[model samples]
Target: MVVDELNEGRIGLEEMKVGGIFPNLKVFKNKVKEYAIERKFVFVPVDSKPTKYAVRCKDKSCPFRISGRISLDHVMVKRFVPEHTCSGTMRGNDHPLVTAAWAADTCLGLFPCPGDVRPTLIRAYIKDKWGITISYVKAFNAKIIIHEKMCGNAEASYRILPAYAEEMERCNPGTIMCVYRSRELWTGGDSTFCRLFWSFGPSIRAFSQTIRPLILINGTHLRGKYKGILLAATAVDGDGGLFPLAYAVVENEMYESWL
Candidate 1:
């Protein structure tokens, strides 16, 4: 589990000093990256191990460096030289520390709502926040990176449908969720996702009680890593708003799939 100190505003890179402690090596590395990116500098890890970490400014002549070692499950900075002799203007357009994952995390921190953010917004946010201009491709890749992190890989999501359906039924009685597999894993020695149909108890009850009798059904194409189709059953509410009823995910929108 990540330590609470890793949360935003709990700690800042400028606060790092000699003998400072970090929850783990990953946090330490990330802090260093944030420090370098924010200052428009570049650092190269001289040594990175399970228990120890060391980095120096990319310019060999620069004195900016940090070294840490693990102690009691936390990394303690043993040495820190916060002095830079090289001109910090070496960075052009983008810094080496500004990776796709870093860009994604920064965008998520600045813009908490994922659905409301776009690649152009991500590019602008990075430029405004870090003074680093990344390519459109990089911003788009950052979007993809965070999307996979928030919503797991498509293939893995399909594999967890059975358990998800079970949990849904347990949490909300009268919920209808079905998962169809191409084959039984134990008996057939393999299994693959074929289709899924789910209708939450709340949505079902709400539609039955307040929605219009007329229902509109539609299917949309999934353009993610895994290709499939999403079928949704929606009803018009008294306010003329669409009320979600049931949904299905299938390989294709065919007669059997609708049934």
Candidate 2:
């Protein structure tokens, strides 16, 4: 019932704010805890398993790497593992397994496109939130931003995207894959495709049997509706996938074209 009476109640928590003891705690929200404290450290505990929401370093050299990000489809909730070894400094940044993985990117890309390439939430967290230098290539575990329009019952667009994705894997086996959408995929002046593939190509192979062994295609239509298509094709790879793959459709009736 009173401030001095709190200790008599035998509560274990110490360092109650001044206002918290009183009726109105809003005035004490800004008060500091008198206990020992330090800044947010830059280390993940050894043996600590991180949540899907945790960030990975954008540096391929960083030791604290993360697994897949949380998504509407792959709604994973797993324990964390230390990105670095339990003890000792890391060997180097490029040591593959022991080293970290990054999302190598030369340009800023929006996401849910399926391409391993993308601008990450880590980039936003670093640049916008933390003001840190986030590397596009090194943030292997960062979540790429997705267009709300691009996500849907197709399970956030990742479900139906596998068709072209199969081709991307077939053609560019080692490369990270992606999917995007556009309302219009025109074909002319090297600018036939809609904005989805506006920046994409004149591939090595045209739409023929032997020439069109592999493909990747999707669209990120501005309307955010279910009305776009994309495609990419390539030679079969050792994995029975394709090679020299492009990523989307640049023409009309693309889904039908795939048929």
Candidate 3:
């Protein structure tokens, strides 16, 4: 404990609570994640690189910085994973911890919104929870396509997010939020996931109707500590089925950040 680090409360490295001690670090992590989201707290992922300099340079216009990096590659979902999931082995599909799948489970909330069944309400709910709204810098869309979108036989490339402190600090130059870029569209195997899930409820029904409702979602890490953006679409019909139509990873949302 930091108390142990200090001599009888005397000044030591610095007085602080021990962030982790028990093997169940996840206990504290869950508390922090929920608190952060509910409080609209933006978390900056720690940079992995050792800082040759004290604090990172605060140049807003630095290309490596958020203010300068107009096209943030860090927006991909892959960047959110941690060290434990992959014994540090495997590539592309090799994260021993923090997969994009895990991120979604966390951000969906401990409970559904009392009245946020509407896409607009869902949008409002997410905005209130994470302090972000629809914008192009973090533009992700959900459009109902006539056909399914499967990349199994298609050419593709995905992002690999940085997991270091220096890179993270630079990525979030303003030092307010973090970006974990990704392309995790949840289109079902059916001809249309949108139509398949109609009539689930008022929320799902209304959500299913929007052919192109801009959806912003985030996946929770397996350890359930981190969260990131997930943009998806749904279909609306007489019965109201809300199926995932399509989606992409995204980032920064200024008042002018509409998709």
Candidate 4:
């Protein structure tokens, strides 16, 4: 699911009551971390377990602390001390709790297209929106994390090609799907993916009967971490609209690949 906003009516550190209930431990932890980031404070975990979680202000002298425990499949806050006695000097641009995974999830909505997400843009966005300063490496890592979350990793995607082709053929009986692998499979138990081609049954029939005779074949470079070319075939319908007929992904635009 796509998350559009943060803190969206969810309870924060200040708003949390002693008996407040959170859906799960992850939600409770995320809320606390987000609160810490927003308030420019630091929290150190005092007690962390499967059924219980506890944290106090980074400053040992501070009296602010909170703890929650799992109760009947939900985490219930058992202790709450929202006030802090120490001066907020431990907070700064860098936060130890802000991880790449957390940043990726927090700003997922900003990355509609993974290709356009640059590290510099991510850094600027986080700084401007959340008042948090993250290093370039963290921003770059966050981009990678978001890319994998949006589109599966390259290795996993390659491994599932055969299953995807089988499922496609099963769903559309007349669909044509093919996966080619390189001959080098001795070292790694999995075969190296070379190319993939697919065409839907409905699209083939529509192109043959209703679409225009003119076929436009074009090839574009894939923008993911893997370097490849995306070859596509489309036909102009009666309304001057392009209708997709087939697609192929190959290591390069070669005669054999097109064939």
Best by TM-score: 1
After TM-score superposition, the amount by which residue 71's alpha carbon in candidate 2 deviates from its true location, in angstroms, is 26
Q: Write the per-residue lDDT of candidate 4 for residues 1-259, one digit (tens) a residue.
A: 1111244344544656788777777777887888777777889999998778999999999898999987656788899888878767345687777889888877777877877878888889888877889999998899999888888788898898899999999988789999999875677665788899999998999988999999899999887678999999999999999999999999889899999
| Candidate 2 per-residue lDDT over residues 3-103, each given as its tens digit | 33323223222433221232222111111110111111133323222323333333435554323233333223232233443333323222221111222
Q: Is candidate 2 or candidate 3 better by lDDT?
A: 2
The TM-score measured for candidate 4 stands at: 0.74
The 10-residue segment with the lowest total lDDT in model 1: 1-10
Q: Candidates' lDDT values, in order? A: 0.83, 0.34, 0.28, 0.83
Model 4 worst lDDT run, 10 consecutive residues = 1-10
The estimated TM-scores of all candidates read 0.75, 0.21, 0.20, 0.74
Candidate 3, residues 82-172: lDDT per residue as tens digits? 1122122223422222222223332334325422222343334445644545331111111001001211111111221233323544654
TM-score of 3: 0.20
The residue-level lDDT of candidate 4 at 152 comes to 72
Worst 10-residue lDDT window, candidate 2: 30-39
Off by over 4 Å in 2: 1-40, 44-125, 138-259
lDDT of 3: 0.28
Regions of candidate 3 where Cα sits further than 4 Å from its true position: 1-18, 21-107, 110-118, 136-259
Clashing pairs in 1: none
**Clash counts for all predictions:** 0, 37, 41, 0
